[model samples]
Target: MQIASPLINELQCGERLNHAIEHGRRGEFALLLAMLSQDARDMAQFTLGEEGTVDAKLRRQFELPPAQTLVADVADDSLVNNGGEFHELGLRGFALQQALKPEALVTRGPISVTMLDALNNTDPLCKSRYLEPQHPALPEIPHFNDRLSGQLALAQRMAQA
Candidate 1:
């Protein structure tokens, strides 16, 4: 997790700015990815025992747009939190991601690097009756959590056409 290292540095104030930018130069989804990247940077500010503080930092990031990158770093920590059904979910997601686009587009700019989406997708609550019946996720147990529910209800109401 190279990201873990720089994240530590950013937190410690090695540079004036405490984060690296995941440059999302494309449209909306890319910007969302960029914001998530900035969120990752914001997350780095918490000290070791302050792990619990990440949620509030993320909440604040979700409230704003991504800033332009002064510099960027690529970190591959995809396997950091692997376990249980998550293992199966990771395999499936890796397969799907590969199948969708085996090669990333240089011209398309930064694509969103969603970490552990498979975990949310496989959540038992999401598989339960919480999601709307009409949701496309009804048939897919593993892809159900991203649909409208308590955590996503706000997103649902604010969804764009």
Candidate 2:
């Protein structure tokens, strides 16, 4: 099965932000962290991996408001950890950034012109789960599943009429 890409937009970010705040208020760390931006997600994962760090850093970030000064001060650094240690970039900061400016996360680097061609050429309906073809091909008659065979035969007769 093909995996659909995650939808991220201003409206979606705003909804997620509100949901995350509710989760934080309820002290649901896992649920709150799940709504974090990619960068914050990575930081949370790394922080959780380190022994004796969650209670002191990441959990506190989850409890605070996104607009708080502590949350707003987190710097967006490279994904890599150079010195074999994880730094706290504040998950609240990431959430605030996402809420205030979702376009930054949506913006991708320069892509090949062929990308647009592929998108334009693709049939959007072909990917739909509920799509029904107007002229469906009849299956082999008198095959397995007697009910389906009878239905196909009736359809074939109807088409000829």
Candidate 3:
């Protein structure tokens, strides 16, 4: 699954924090100390999984109950406003945002192909360091070289007109 950059960064940060806690390295501990205030760490535990022995115990101590496991209940109107209405435009925009899973997009019915095409036409920003540009079909999308050439040609034509 393609994770977003922010999520990837958070995972990396979490791993670093875990490492720091495990090794008890003063420098890493100090860095985390400086970067995260107590309130920030509380928020992190709520959002990202809680890390660090002390932090986890502190979370329990503070009665900052573990975050709910189930997805939050969202209203249908909110879903529609958020582009979940299953229309072509909504699906296209949703695909652009990388919000819809491939299966979910496909199962939504007739607009699936168009949505998939639009998704194919777009490129996801590389998120994780482990991710490689290895998808075989990725090369078919208009690369920067072609896009630049098209823009220049359009500019030249406009200039003449």
Candidate 4:
């Protein structure tokens, strides 16, 4: 009988999580939650940060009960230095290693809570924090209106030309 390394098992768990998010598999997410080690689960929940508040607010507005367990609440800024946005795109391996380092989690705070939240509720069709700006539950910022007007003006100019 062969023994699997803990690191290898964790990596596989992370991969399963990634697949669940990418494919929007709520059932798979549930299974992953069940199978994930407590440490990994804690890391996932810790990463939700501000996103957890956002999720709670939205849930209350919709009359949904407050979430008890982790809900894939992705962190705004943890792995990436890019202004509170997720930057690790298409990272192939080391999902658990990259995601759940205790030192990193403690130092940098929750890095991927949004994905944790996604596992619970795959609705709204935009699970990743990177797409959070488009989530309907989140109100549009005032600057977004100014930016939109500028974009429309630019588009009009191009059309006239």
- The candidate maximizing TM-score is 3
Candidate 2 TM-score, C-alpha based: 0.16
Give the lDDT of residue 62 in candidate 1: 87
Residues 18-131 of candidate 4: C-alpha lDDT, one tens digit per residue: 888899999988866665445443354355555566668789789975343232324533332222223444343345434443113233323344545554464333333334
**Residue-wise C-alpha lDDT for candidate 3, range 51-94, written one tens digit per residue:** 64766778878987554223222322222233454465576666
Clashing pairs in 2: none
Task: Give the top-scoring candidate (lDDT).
Answer: 4
Error of 4 at 6 (Å): 8.8
| Alpha-carbon shift of residue 24 in model 4 (angstroms) | 1.2
Model 1 C-alpha lDDT per residue in residues 89-120, reported as the tens digit of each score:
77777566545434232222122224234434
Please give the CA lDDT of all the candidate structures: 0.40, 0.42, 0.49, 0.49
- Each model's TM-score? 0.14, 0.16, 0.20, 0.19
* lDDT leaderboard ranking: 4, 3, 2, 1
Candidate 4 stretches greater than 4 Å from native? 1-10, 39-161
Candidate 2 local lDDT, 12-130, one digit each (tens):
34465577566666554454444444443334334445445555565576784333122221133422222222134466655555454432222232223354444445443332211
Q: How far is candidate 2 from the true structure (C-alpha RMSD, Å)?
A: 24.5
The residue pairs found clashing in candidate 1 are: none
Clashes of each: 0, 0, 0, 17
